[model samples]
Structures are given as structure tokens and as C-alpha cells.
Target: MPAKQRSFAQTLNAVAWSFIGLRRRRDFDEDVGALNPFYVIAGGVLGCALFIALLLGAVRLAVA
Candidate 1:
């Protein structure tokens, strides 16, 4: 059977779970088959950038 395509939101959810290291094996397997590579990479990069920005903002606030 062919893998089903996932929506952008679904891909983002998978990327978020990956970042937090909290995905279940079954869900991971499902996501692996459903997610798009482009969305995964874009979402991961965006998520990382957002995380870094939040950390920097927090540090700046603490120092000020």
C-alpha cells in the first residue's frame, strides 16, 4: 500500500514532538510514512530558530 500524505499541521506536530523527544514508537512509524521531507526540514529549521530566539529573549530579559 502507498503511504498517505500528511497535512502541514501534522508535519509540524511531528517535528515538534521530535524536538521534545517525546514521540511514541507507533506514532513515529506512522509519521515516517506520512510526512513530507520538505515540510519536515522546513518545520525543524523554523522550530529551532524560534527556540533560539526565545532563549535569547529570556536571557536578555534576565540581564536587563
Candidate 2:
């Protein structure tokens, strides 16, 4: 069967779960076929940026 395409939000959700290393085995299996490469890469980069920004914000808050 052909893989089903995912929406942007679904892509980001998958990326977020991946970043934290918290996906269920079954879900990961399903996502393996469903996630778009372009969306995955974009979401990964965006997630990384947001994570860095949050860390910086927290550090600034602590310092201030």
C-alpha cells in the first residue's frame, strides 16, 4: 500500500516526539511511512531553533 501523507501539524508532532526520544514502537513504525522528508527536516530545524531559544530565555531569566 502507498504511504499516507501527513499534515504539517502531524509532521511537527512527530519531530517533537523524536527530539525527546519518546515514541511508542507501534507509532514509530506507522510514522516511518507517513512522515514527509521535507516536513521532517523543516520541523527538526524549527524544533531545534525553538529549543535553543527557550534555553537562552531560561538562562537570561535566571541571570536577571
Candidate 3:
């Protein structure tokens, strides 16, 4: 099977989905071949940062 072409948005979306723990086997398989490593790394880092920021904000809000 041919690899599916993925854009930067797609890579970012995939990384977000992964962080959210929602993924299908088919999509994972497609991403394996289509996603650029550099894009994935960048997306993952950005996603992690956003996630951390959100969590920190929530925690601060709860504590205050």
C-alpha cells in the first residue's frame, strides 16, 4: 500500500489526538509512513507545551 500524504496540519492534529489518547489503528498505520519526523517532533513539543500550560492554569485556578 502507498503511504498517505500528510501536511503539517495533519501532523499537528495527529500529535494532538495522540496526547488526548484517541487513535485508530488505521490512522496510526497511515501516519507511520506519511508523517515527517521533523514535523512530528516539532508538533509533539508544541503540543506538550500547550498541554502543560493548560494543566498548570487549571491547577492554579483550582488552588485560588
TM-score of each: 0.94, 0.91, 0.86
Q: Is candidate 1 or candidate 2 better by lDDT?
A: 2
Which residue segments of model 1 deviate by more than 4 Å? none
Model 1 agreement with the true structure over 1-64: per-residue lDDT tens digits: 8789999898999999889999999999877878999999999999999999999999999999
Clashing pairs in 1: none
Clashes of 3: 0
Candidate 3: segments with Cα more than 4 A from true spot: 1-4
Worst 10 residues of 2 by lDDT: 23-32
Question: Candidate 3 lDDT, tens digit per residue, 1-64?
Answer: 7787789999999998988889888999878989999999999999989989999999999999
What's the distance in Å from true for residue 7, model 2?
Answer: 1.1
Candidate 2 C-alpha lDDT tens digits along 1-64:
9779899999999889889999889988998989899999999999999999999999999999
Model 2 residue runs over 4 Å out of place are none
User: What ranking of all candidate models by lDDT puts the best one first?
Assistant: 2, 1, 3
lDDT of 3 at 33: 88
